[model samples]
Target: MLISKTVKINQTDNRVESVSCGECKGNKNHKILVSAEMAQDEDSCFDYQVIQCLGCNRISFRHALYEYTQYQATSEKIYPDPKQRLPIEGINLLKPYIQSIYKETLKTINNNQVILFGTGIRTILEAITQEQKTPGIDLNEKINNLVKQGLVTQKDVGALHDLRRIGNEATHSITPSSPKEIKVAMDVIEHLLQRIYILPHNVKENLSSPLKNKPNTK
Candidate 1:
């Protein structure tokens, strides 16, 4: 049996905590709006709080567990997780499906979905190859095709292969990538997307007109 009590905190309560806000995309001060406690037994209890970010006014739920028998330590988790990486600049320039996959891949890593993270990374790479119409039967050959098409150089193929290996390990052997490894992989992907999609779009939008008007000397 569990006993619980809900408390409605007033605006004047002034209880604030530093937490990551999805809208703000970083840690900010959040004021507690409502709080509740449930006691599973004499030795353990759970705390739930509704918090609103002071900066962005974004709301989030925080849950914590306390055990008196375990030296009064507390374990806390935030609902909906927190944003880990912001969308890459000019992400809208990519194909719609690729943009969606890229955003979801970021979320997967942010939520600590290790297996999904690897798979997502792989999916992003494959989507790029498909969008570019690289001719290959499999991902390995497709990645190499990217080089022949002048999409990526020999140096970049090595990094793409590393990402492919990580994905394979996760999908086939159930291996989990570390956070640092995930971060590097994401960086590489972002760079590739920027070079192939965003940068070209930017150049065309910003530089094409200027170059067109330059007086030709030859």
Candidate 2:
């Protein structure tokens, strides 16, 4: 059970969902390497710990200050996890530099920094348009340029425009984005990444190999 959204530990249970591993690009189970607790009252306490990520053999420290009675907690990332996330060589979209930027966007969202998350998603879109070689004075023009250059279709124009609109809102601070909007933006970007990056890379690999997706005719 990975808690993708929640950051606080369940005070009474002495456990929390493992944080995302930048190296693995997914959540991995963790163990309390060391812990200390202080009781503020008979019914409340705070716990702090150094936890180890089991997946990539990396260590990072985070401490949860929790009050069990009121169910209040605040966390601090005492030591920044210095490990750079390994690129997904399996997908071309995981180019080291670009992938790092995208991962940071994910990290912001995971940490509940809602505004930055919108801006981050917007940056990803800019990266995609750049890679496609669609140049423009601004993102809207760049996206329109993509459609003009035949890199994108009319079918996809709406989604791309919607993503741009969200970014524009964030940049202008028109309104704060809801969690639902962020979730949808994440979905849209991942879909774009998969289609533009992963699919083409996989297609090339398949073409280079004898294996092909053919209809079975036995």
Candidate 3:
């Protein structure tokens, strides 16, 4: 989600600022170019580009495009097996990009049990549907039940649909797609996965001492 807000820049009054890329910490740079309209004098609109980080390739924007952030609460829906992740196509690796994002998000949450907190339903459903080619009948019913249980929210469900649509298009296109399209799909999948899965269990164990644990943490 992109949100726009005004921030004071260089002592200049309020200027629009928004976070462009969440992972790489890059910002957006909004430059306005004037073009003559046929009926009107001039039209102005903010341009969009991810100001990538030199060291880490993170992206952010200078002008406020609404920032993209994960929802705190989520809905339940199991996803397919990891083997079902989007294809890398030209890349020799199998879903390495997606795996990296999973690890990165896990690190951010600083807990492993939390990994499955928001993802139990999605992971299970995807594993069943994608691997077994089963219909999504009971899966969606479970999702509704989960929503009633407060396992996930409507917004997360919508985001999941959006990500799945983009992923399906990139993977199942009849004609070969451009590298940029593949990259966007991969990035979107990674982002979606990161947002849904908080952190994996193994990560939490390895990051902390055995005695430092707390009850009912996740």
lDDT of each: 0.84, 0.68, 0.35
lDDT of 3 by residue, 1-218 (tens): 33333332233122233333333334333222211111111222222322333444443333312211421111111122111223222222224443444444333223333223124223433542333344346555443443454435666555445434443443455233344443343354454343334233335546655664645566
Candidate that beats the other on TM-score, 1 or 2, i.e. the better one: 1
Q: After superposition, how far is residue 122 of candidate 3 from its true place, in Å?
A: 13
By summed lDDT, which 10 consecutive residues of candidate 3 come out lowest?
72-81
Q: For model 2, how does the per-residue alpha-carbon lDDT over 1-218 read when each residue is reduced to its tens digit?
A: 32233223433354544665656667776666666666655554556667667887666676566555544345445355533322234444566655766788778766777777777888888888777778899998898887787767888888888888887887897555788887788877777777777878888876655545655677
Q: Report the Cα lDDT for residue 149, model 1.
A: 96
RMSD of each: 7.1, 10.3, 18.0
Q: How close is candidate 3 to the true structure, as a TM-score?
A: 0.27
How much does candidate 1 score in TM-score? 0.63
For candidate 1, lDDT tens digit of each residue in 77-145?
Answer: 887676556688899889999999999999888788888888889999999999999999999999999
Ranking by TM-score, best first? Answer: 1, 2, 3
Clashing pairs in model 2, backbone N/Cα/C closer than 3 A: none
Error of 1 at 24 (Å): 13
